[model samples]
Target: MGDPTAEANRGLAVGPFAHDGVWLRCALHCHTTQSDGMLSPAMLRRYYSMGHFDVLAITDHDQLTPAPDAHSEDDDLLLLPGTEISLRSPESGGPLHVLGLGVNAMPRVPERATLLETAAAVQAEGGLAFVAHPWWTGLRSDELGDLAGVTGIEVYNAGCEVEQGRGDSAQYWDTLLSQGLPMLAIATDDHHYPGFDAFQGWTMVRAATRTPEAVLAALAAGHAYSSNGPDIHGIWIEADRIRVASSPAVAISLLGAPPRGVRVNAGPHGLKQPGDVPRGADGRRNGAYPGNLLTEATFPLLTGSPYLRVEVLDAHGRKAWSNPIWLPARG
Candidate 1:
């Protein structure tokens, strides 16, 4: 197997688990009354604050929502100036939503800009652009494969999931990855309504400080993970294997190219420890093991696998996803 540490040092690193930084819970995509959201900007801030989010970006549609001029000392929430611009995809002619996070101001583009034009505009304004909910937008993997200057895609969107069954885009992500695009993925609430769609998903960013600039920088560097409930403590890649430590989960999977992944499920035989086969409360092996009993796992790196990412699924079906760790080709 190849040495993953060496590959990471060569600038192919994804997770920042070995780095020094604080993990900030971030809501990267959402709206307020400024767009078609239920809450106003002030109320949205308070909602996320009460939910214990450390950073937030109010990506109102077609317009930038300015951050507050001043915040109270007790208010530690870092608000980033952002917007969600709608662009036309030449392949499909449908609207493509691109999130512009941390832009100083909205950029100038044609009324019906292409995805490339939109991404360039967002980047020109010093913002990071992300393709939001490609599956929900009915975008084919081929259409998104050649994208440039875009940071990533939303692998899971709570709003789309709740409203329709088209939110999980991991398949599209894998297709893109198989084609050799080093793309990142995020899970978001894309929240428009409270109670029903808020706090369903978020990104945990590793930043040196609790400021907007720091958070944006961390995101641009791919120092983050997306989750709905499970927490990934760490992911380490060694010479011959990859190890993952996470909160108690029902399953931990290392996903890679087709036919090149590993899944560890906490079944009736829990870790198969000497006497750890779980039994039902009635004292029978009826496969009633506690769902959140598997906390850590390791898997050998598959030879010829181009890239690998980790997914941790908890008892409640919530999942946390790591960005891909691209592997170096063997000489």
Candidate 2:
């Protein structure tokens, strides 16, 4: 089988996204027909190019994605194949969807297939399979433990986080980090419309170009930074140590620091912060924690903590995300 990280990195030679070590940006998950999305792959490709997105995956429901091999590339845009295998719960047989990116063909995961069986097929394909939107689906994201060779978890889903423009999904991953797993956190739009751009949370990956391979490589090797807006240019990590930066000339602040501290600095996106992961009153962070305006703070790196990452949000609170920057195992 091919290495997903190596495949993802090879495409770096393709564009300006490759110019001078800048990270390429992309949306890893989204839908189209091959399943139930309002926008066709062609329409999505048009919008992605105009919006300056480097790449995207069309992970349709219960079907494999080649995303309409029909859309013409207008220059810097790329469409990758993916599929959201709709695994059903054994208890009530409800949906337990898993996303498979960068696969060459579909491996069968019957609708009634257990999550573990489905994940096996996905891993077998040499693709990265993530448990998507578990909080929304009434399942815990951590349930992937029953399976082997799983990668990534949607800690936040912007579409599910409709309240104050932040997704509750990150909490699930944060909880996992507290226990020390290299659970790659991400923000997804799960978008279905041009109108639903609000769901478009993503990661700025250190990749050669915006391709399925680049995104996966950035994701696997822990080289990605997340964002709703205000790009996360690069990150600094050392053991329990952590430092985050964004596009130059921006302010940075860390939010929710009591046992935790929020710090800010200048460089990429111009800021950084650290905070004790907050638990909501009902024990759910339905709001943007660690505060918004990622480019506004001065902070220190905690060299003993077992985990760390930064949340990047735009000033409007419209788009944002958290990417895992440090994990005890991976760091």
TM-score of each candidate structure, all chains considered together: 0.88, 0.72
- Model 2, position 66: C-alpha lDDT score: 56
Against the unseen true structure, what C-alpha lDDT does each candidate score?
Answer: 0.79, 0.56
Candidate 2 Cα outliers beyond 4 Å, as residue runs: 1-22, 69-73, 89-94, 141-144, 163-166, 209-211, 237-242, 247-298, 318-322, 327-331
Model 1 lowest lDDT segment of ten: 277-286
Output candidate 2 Cα RMSD. 9.2
User: How far in Å is the alpha carbon of 145 misplaced in model 2?
Assistant: 3.6
- Candidate 2 residue-wise lDDT, 240-299, digit = tens: 333344432223443321244353422223222244232210001112324333332223
Give the Cα error of residue 66 in candidate 1, in Å: 1.8
- Among these predictions, the greatest TM-score belongs to 1
For model 2 the local lDDT of residue 108 reads: 74
Tens digits of lDDT, candidate 1, 154-194: 88899988999777888888888887887888888999999
